[model samples]
Target: MTALPGPVSPPPRLLMGPGPISAYPSVLRAMSSELVGQYDPFMTATMTETQELYRQVWGTANEATLLVDGTSRAGIEAALISLIRPGDRVLVPVFGRFGHLLAEIAERALGEVHTIEVPWGQVFPVSAIEEAVVRVKPHLLALVQGDTSTTMLQPLEDIGALCARHGVLFYSDATASLGGNPFEADAWGLDAATAGLQKCLSGPSGSAPVTLSERAVEVIGGRRRIEAGIREEGDEDAPDFIRSNYFDLGMILDYWGPRRLNHHTEATSMLYGARECARLMLIEGRDAVMARHRLHGEAMLAGVQGLGLVVFGDVAHKMTNVVAVEIPEGVDGDAARSAMLADFGIEIGTSFGPLHGRVWRIGTMGYNARKDAVLTTLACLEAVLRRHGASVPSGGGVDAALDVYAGAGA
Candidate 1:
């Protein structure tokens, strides 16, 4: 093989896809700050600060909050594996592909899984989950707050009350909804909630932020273990071992606890990035950042409609970041997307699982959730469609989006 080139560089482009929305400049700058070893005092302090930032973002006072050293799925695994023992029952209310993923992971953790699926493009009512819980009497009730696969937001406000009344631990994967939608961890009675920075947080996707309520913490601690490496020979009997070594929430908590036991080497750059992402949102105020995403999403929806594309999903229940658009006939979805990236330097996404080839998912999230980014994406999309033999009114989509932005005046 030929020797590698001196240095590799990447072509920069506007990211307007379903996830990995463009990161804020501050987030990037934070990642470039000086690096330190995992146990270094400054590094550990930074980790503490990062946890505090996410706690504010999550609107929770739970003391077991910390970042998983992997993506959103890592957080999900940690929550499931630590809480779900063999033969324990878990009830999953599925609305999209990621819901299936939750069930799969819980099953691997040896849960006796039960599922009730709403239609692909719809979410269940609180009564539905409550009814299922009553019938199934499961130990845990798991769902996703917003499933980007369908571009639909699952309403959790009332579900929490039902779970609390029924005595089932509530868990949710808020990977796609955390910042774009209003989420209150404690108020909603969420026992465990996890998310990644790739979506509305506007950071790289490596680290996952997670929090657990006191009740959930008690359940997880039931299976905790004293690490042999640190335990004295005469110490009290060790706590029961968690199912998976790597996903042991107890061990992770210890690493982030007062004792500072060693876990995986945290992703330092990602920690910096995640910290700054939360910092920026905190500075903007959570409600304001959510409003910005909402306005941009409305403008994008209007622009897509002006371009003669049909918007998908239940409009009233959709999230403020991603929009699902119906693909028109006689045009190749993959080809148009490739053209958008290659010619216009804009990235859009197609659906996953069942919705594949039937819809195009365009997102206005995080740092890209702005008027300029929204209008530019609309303009480029119009150009790509026209060049690819689809009909479009000249300056139609862009002008429509501009009108919305102009009216909103931000």
Candidate 2:
């Protein structure tokens, strides 16, 4: 028989990657809280409170904000599968890997998908998306607010108003941008937005926080259907039922709403963690958290540049949470990344598709977004680069980062 694995003792790692980074300690403590009955009064009350906290996080007054018991991708599927009906024209602006993910999910929903592509490192201009909207006349425009693959933040401020003008529903996957960056769900006129706790929320990847505008709620409401075993006398299922049962937002909303309808058993510990993540964000103030991320992000960017590393993508459009730097010409990117992990216990990221083996992604967000974290990552990265025979100036990385903190008086 194979030997049983010993009690799970994973090696300590500083996740400076694009995602699945270090979760906040308070969040981990909350996740360890004892479980309770799903329908218990305390559980229901906590659920309601979590909803309220997320409203502040999303900057929305939408009544349908809630947690989906899965990763951020699950939240995206829930929104896409529920809102997009068969043959509905959906326009997707593809900038990076996540944009393709959105288009793929929409296709699985049987929507007539149309796409407008920009180069991997860039984002679509609002005028370009508006042109697509006019031509495709899509029922929904799905986009990603931040694509970590390229570390680019797509401008959403103008796109939402453009969608509204075109009478098109708008959805954005904000998994990588929400807490660390500025997101105004209501002010931006977004119909739906989804994010996971693992990124900017500084929590584990089990819960996805999602918010739907009233208009989005109405669209999802039209597709509601109670499962046969849970059906009530007055409940009416829709003729155009959502294709996916698990991803049906309408049923999920019912579970979170005042009716207290039973759906899946709540992931109790995850709910606790999710609540704490939101609670901490609200306590710090959203703008303050974004500022912290920005400060550290700038430091990291300066640090890498000072090490003579070429930064990837359009710097102006890069996300405040993550930055991608081109791998040196002669150094093996994967080997360098592995050395950083094994030697320093720091984990950076590799890019995807067109950027694969071309760039290394480093992140400064959530619990890891701090001056110390930025300085340490830069210091160790310089060591690793030098060991790999890449020319790196001594103290260049850390000094550049320190100068940034000094300039910010942080």
Off by over 4 Å in 1: 225-241
Name the top TM-score candidate: 2
Instruction: Write the residue-wise lDDT of candidate 1 on 1-410 in tens digits.
Output: 99878776867878898897788989989999999999999999998998899899999999899999898899999999888867789999999999999999989988899999988888898778888999999989989999999999999988778988888999999999999999999888899999999999999899999999999988776655333334445535544336677889988998998899987888899999999999999999999999999999999998998899988878888999999998888789999999989988889999998899999999999999998898999999988888778898888888888888889886
Question: Candidate 2: TM-score?
Answer: 0.96
Tell me the TM-score of model 1.
0.95
| Candidate 2 residue 312 C-alpha distance from true site, Å | 0.6
Model 2: per-residue Cα lDDT over 183-213, one tens digit each: 9999999999999998889999989999999
TM-score of each: 0.95, 0.96
On lDDT, the leading prediction is 2
Give all candidates' CA lDDT scores.
0.89, 0.92
